[model samples]
Target: MKGFLEDANYSIGLLDEGATLADIIDNCIYEHTHTGKRAFYVGDLGKLVKKNTQWQNVMAPIKPFYPVKCNSTPGVLEILGTLGIGFACSNKSEMVLVQDLGISPENIIYTSPCKQASQIKYAAKTGINIMTCDSDIELKKIARSHPNAKLLLHIATEDITADEEMNMKFGTTLKNCRHLMECAKEFGIQIVGVKFHISSTCKDLQTYIHAISDARCVFDMAEEFGFKMNILDIGGGFTGSELQLEEVNHVIRPLLDVYFPKESGVNVIAEPGCYYVSSAFTLAVNIIAKKTECDKLLPSGVEQARDDEPVFTYYINDGVYGSFASKLSEKLNTTPEVHKKYKEDEPLFTSSLWGPSCDELDQIVENCLLPELSVGDWLIFANMGSGTLGEQSTFNDYQRPLIYYMMSFSDWDEMQDAGIASDTLMKNFFFVPSCIQLGSEDRFSTAA
Candidate 1:
């Protein structure tokens, strides 16, 4: 137990051996039942420490620079910062956040694809020199705003991805690499290395093989222009799976050793956004309204057979306009596990989850199977910290959810062992329950 912590971003609960995520959730739900039910996110900062260790073990030589766009939660940033992880920021605000955390400018890279000129100038003012550029226009933009900027030329990947629409080429083609290099030389911009963009959703491991090979070609081309390139950033495609990590490492490790060997002095790094924080967060949304329809037409206008099966529609406190914002871009197959206890033999009904906005497009989970739910019952969605709650604009002002950060004492000890200053974390937070509101001066409890 310690003094209370009050932060706009979140209040963390340092869990002891007996406390569990389940205990915290139950306590949060119990408090909300007496007060008002609201949607909130529970982040396990311990998971981040484990993920960092996993990255070190599997992708050792290749350093990880976490992309801020994945999830910019304050707690995430704080823990990652303390773990000695570098950052890959996309915009000014992200830079400001990392800067606020006292991260050095050299440890940050501005990787925004379409960077605003103002942001470039801001980076220059702040002494952040590394940024990525793909085209002549972007190169010029960077050259004009940040004359001393160290650049990583972004190149298009040859491998196709699952979403054909997102597959539209972004980075400059390899053939055009010389042209960009020429431009960089003319502008006197320092080309430090090449960057290959790969999304985490792409399961194909061949993408890494091809992308790394292409990057080697880029490195050789840069040499022709007298540019001493050293960094090869295989941009963020990590899915947080240990199996996938090993698979990717197996494919690229040999290639890296052969192409940009240890003697080459080329620093290889990666942008792992979701890999560190995805599984660390859980979102809990309360059922605000419920509707039961028997043999009625669903949203697809498909009429169900008169099999006497019931369909349920549940309206939750948060929706597309809030915590489930990522639903707009990708299909979320997250089926929530009900928090309330139920009979094993209970009949499960066809169900759909909707957000509070009531906008037709605000549907969170299109269809799921669950036992009949009441208005006050809570549903838990796991692995939610991967960018669902990013960009504050989408949230309805009244419905914005708060975050509760938690980590087991053993994990905290491990983080301290991993070189993070334990005293640095002391002032950030003390201890408190997730949903309970305590005065700043109140003595905080480690109870889950």
Candidate 2:
């Protein structure tokens, strides 16, 4: 634990014998509010959009259509609505939400490739007239249901990835793309454009260029068949984190300049879900349990949870079941770096971190490097949840914590005379409630 403290850059006081984990959470919550501490803070989407000027500068040449599935929180959607960016809705429910939010119908591209007939009909009925299709069957289904609908031909590429497999389920292979375009002509349906994706976490620079080249070929095929394909819906997979945006731009910008000829009368569109929301927040969790054991070579190789002779365990209130379960299920090697507040100099070791859930598989870190940890400690989970820690709240049956937009200086002045700060002040900011303490019986039962 001494090593964990120093490595995390947190100062550790003498352990209090009577203290419990819940006590730590309560104290932290109070301290966060009073001292204006934020457990998670969403990056300002609007500000980011403004700074990058993506819609105006970078994404201008390549039109951006926001994918609502990434975050879709009201706050997120409202901002996109204000930006006048088009939306990529996969279902009727999303269309309904778009309508409720008063998004313009012209700004919606119903991009669900494998869609129910009712969803298709509702899209046509609700006036969300644009959609995507990859197969002759799905094309036929839409044409039969909404005969007069405007459809975009979906093209498959080996480039992009996302949480959902967009290409496998709905996109047409290059040969199939030509076939689908011919099918569109047969069904008397208008094919307005084509779409593709650079799969999530794409590691190559040529991925975008290759996809655009493929799209151009599809466009040329449509032209050969006397179809006027004006829109190219390059489906969402734009990198979201500002940390990676520069790298993304390096990989993407040149591709756009190369294949996108202004004379072609084709408008490039992208469905960027994470790009709009990934850097928006952080998560702070209370440490529930800390254990140390000596171990040799362990199967998991986690210093904390080694199956060897020695192992250490640090339990947090949240875990895979609640906050990051889907990501874990995918066996993705990506893990959040722990933000240390205690000891920064402690030796980091391979350790396992578990969620507070009773399920044995409920864990956050399978094997990670950390100094050590003790009970009643607070740690930060960066990029928590789907789009910061705001994505999945109440996952472990924990109630959603209050989201506070830390006051700016101007707003602070407005309430300065009200004693809002003074009233919320506390001697110590780290405390948790006593009612939810982890009992020995609970731990023992789970181990069995």
Stretches of candidate 1 off by over 4 Å are 1-10, 166-169, 295-307, 394-398, 429-448
lDDT of each model, Cα atoms only? 0.82, 0.59
* Local error of candidate 1 at residue 190 (angstroms): 1.0
Model 2, 199-290: lDDT tens digits are: 66566757767777888788778879888878877676566644455666677666666666677677877777766665443456667677
lDDT: worst 10-residue window of model 1 = 1-10
Superposition error at 213 for model 2 (Å): 2.0
| Model 2 spans > 4 angstroms off | 1-28, 31-47, 51-55, 160-170, 241-259, 289-310, 329-340, 347-349, 385-402, 405-448
List, residue by residue over 135-154, the lDDT tens digit for candidate 1.
Answer: 99999999999999999999
RMSD of 1: 4.4
